[model samples]
Target: MNGSKDIFSTIFSAGTFQMMLRSATPVALAAIGGSMTEHAGIMNIGMEGMILMGAFFGVLGSFLAQSAFAGLALALLVGILAGLFFALLVVRYKSDEFIIGCALNTFAIGLTTYLARNYFPGDASGNPNLPELNLAFLDRIPGLRVINHQSVLVYLTWIIVILAWLFVYKTPYGFWLRASGEKPDTLRTAGISPKKMKWIASVLCGILCALAGAHLSLGQLQGTFTDNMSNSRGFIAFACVIFAAAHPGKAYLAALMFGFFEAIGLRLQGFVSSDLTGMIPYLITIVMMVYVVVRKQRRKMKNE
Candidate 1:
């Protein structure tokens, strides 16, 4: 009974909920951005690279400028440039999106690693850690403890998610974006350029993915940009985008689901073998992917 109580307590702890939100923020942000590209008929497999670039530059800017806001701005600028470069490669040069994406990932990792080693050897792991901002008044409120002791960026992510949902579903521009993907020829006939829509989507994706990176490095990890710190969150975000069918709201839900399992894994780390605990999230992802594939197959069969 004592063991059972302990297990239950761990599962329902405030710490666990906090971990879930922290883990979910980056994935949700990136998924929202990726959804934009998918809506515009672009498969942006370079999201990981964009995120990696953002994380690296975020720390670099913060270290150089000694200000978090300046760091974030610099990261955003770099992210936009990366997006334009990706667009030029796939859209203008007719390069294969998959190959270009792989190249971009490699390029980002190599370039960032080189820069870190040469310019900021001490910060090779990232910049000085970011401090958590707490809402003091909110902390005084009973049951609002969860709302305090969190980075300001985490709160901002929630706002971004809501705004993304509104942008995708409640506006004429959203309609144009969807039309570009579902019926590009029609949109072109309507005098809306599909290419331009795709470009916009690409830029939007870059910005959001960069924010996701910023959240990971600055908000959660406190300004530490370790080599390959992205750790495939970009891919996980892609999976979230697909699982949610490219809807921002649904993507956030999917991300939360991933976060829940990730939190469980962290909680179980001391109780279970670290190796086994580490496998939980990946295993869950595989199961979810299999389920998605099976559902798609069944739907196709029904149509046939």
Candidate 2:
């Protein structure tokens, strides 16, 4: 009984909350971007590729320039180019989004691996770290003090979530974006080009996914870029978009929920097999996806 109590307490500790914040930020950022494209009628499965590209280039830029800001700028530029290229194929040429997405993912993996192996030799341990924010006053607070020290990206993500919610709910462009997915013909009749809206979505998605990747490599991992380091977080962010019904705020919350479970899994490492512990968050994600599918089917049947 004592052991059980201790375990539960440890799982719910302040350290876990910090871990949750760190883990959730990248997914939340990516999911927010994914939600934008989803609302604009684009199924953006290529976020994984965008993220990996950012991870690789972020480190590369930082290594060469010895400046985190330069690294971020390079990552954003790459993201924009990638997004534009993706938009050209999917929106302008009307190619199948799924095939392009798969191609992008494969290409990112191969290209980054090749580049890292050839150009970025040696381990990633010596990379420069992104700066962390320290708010000394938070220590005076009781339970919330854990949030005092975190990556600057964590705070940035919070601002992004608020801005995204406003953008989706309050802006004229947001209305057009949503209408492009649900009623493109109506938008066209109103003199709005749905294709343009899609292009915008793709570009924004790329930039956001790249930012998320930068956060992963630079902020979360402290400036280390490993091949395949993204580790399916892009897919998880896509799932978050679907789970949240493409609402930015809901997507962020869903990401936070996933992050919480992941934090729990990390805490369980000593209590359970390392293999089993690592599976916890992913297993929960699968269960959540299943649940979402079943619920959707049930609603459909009821409506029928």
Candidate 3:
């Protein structure tokens, strides 16, 4: 009992909260993109591949150009190209998104692994990496100051979150995106092609997922690519979409919830086995998904 209390105490500290924000950044970015695709009526499950590719390209661009901005630009370009490929197969050809997504994931792993073997055979730290945003003025503030220093993308994430929320709820395009999924016929009457909307959404998902990968590779302290670096974050971001019903802000919150739990797992490493600790985020994901289903069932029963 005391041990559990001690663990909980350590998990809830400010340091852990800061870590939670850091860990949640990638997930939140992907979740936002997932929400966009979800609202557009396409079941995009290929984020895993997109993220992997982005991470690989981000590092490669940085290494070759010796500039972090070039790395980010490269990641974005790759994302656009990947999004177009996905749209061509799934949107244009009417292919199964799940199958394509799975294929994409497999291709990403094989491709990135092969490239990593060739390009990053050894030390990769000499290349420039994405720098963290250090707010000198915030240093004077207590409490918030400690957590203020994070990846530039981390700070940008909050801005993205706000813009996403605004874009979804306050814009004509947002209505069209949601309508394309929920009321395609109605959207068609308005003369906006649902297919066009789907293509746009898919590309947006690709961009955001790519950004997530870039952040993973260069935005964080690791600042390097590893084999299979995405590590199921794509799926977790999808879970966040479901848990939040495709709401961008809510999805971010869900990602934070997962991040918090994962942070706990990381902290728990000292107290327990690494294997058990690794299960924390996955376990929370399962619970969240189960809860969504249970809630839906309960709502159905109540209506009946």
Best by TM-score: 2
Clashing pairs in 3: none
Residue-level lDDT tens digits of model 2 in 1-304: 9888878998899999999999998899889989989999989899999899988888878888888877788888988988999999999999999999989988999988898887677866456767888877888889769887888888998999999888888999999999999999999999999999999999989899889988888888888889898888889899889888899999999899878878888887778665666566567767877998999899999999
Off-target runs (Cα >4 Å) in candidate 3 are 1-5, 297-304
Off by over 4 Å in 1: 124-131, 293-304
What would the TM-score be for candidate 2 when compared with the true structure?
0.94
Candidate number that wins on TM-score, 2 or 3 = 2
Task: Please provide, for model 3 over 1-304, each residue's C-alpha lDDT reduced to its tens digit, 9 standing for 90 to 100.
Answer: 9998988888888778888999899999999998998998888889889988988898889988989889999999999899989999998999999999999999999999998889888855556788877888887887787477788888888888899899889999988999999999999999999889889988888899999999999987456888899999999888889888899999899889888877877777889775776667677768878888998899999999
Candidate 2: give the clashing pairs. Answer: none
Angstrom error at residue 290, model 1: 4.3
Q: How many clashing pairs per prediction, in order? A: 3, 0, 0
lDDT, candidate 2, residue 19?
Answer: 95
Q: What lDDT is obtained when candidate 1 is compared to the true structure? A: 0.83
RMSD of each: 2.1, 1.9, 1.9
lDDT of 1 by residue, 22-132 (tens): 889888989999999989888878899889888888888888887767778888898899888888887778788889888888888899888878767675544655567
The clash number for model 2 is 0
The local distance difference test score of each candidate is 0.83, 0.87, 0.87
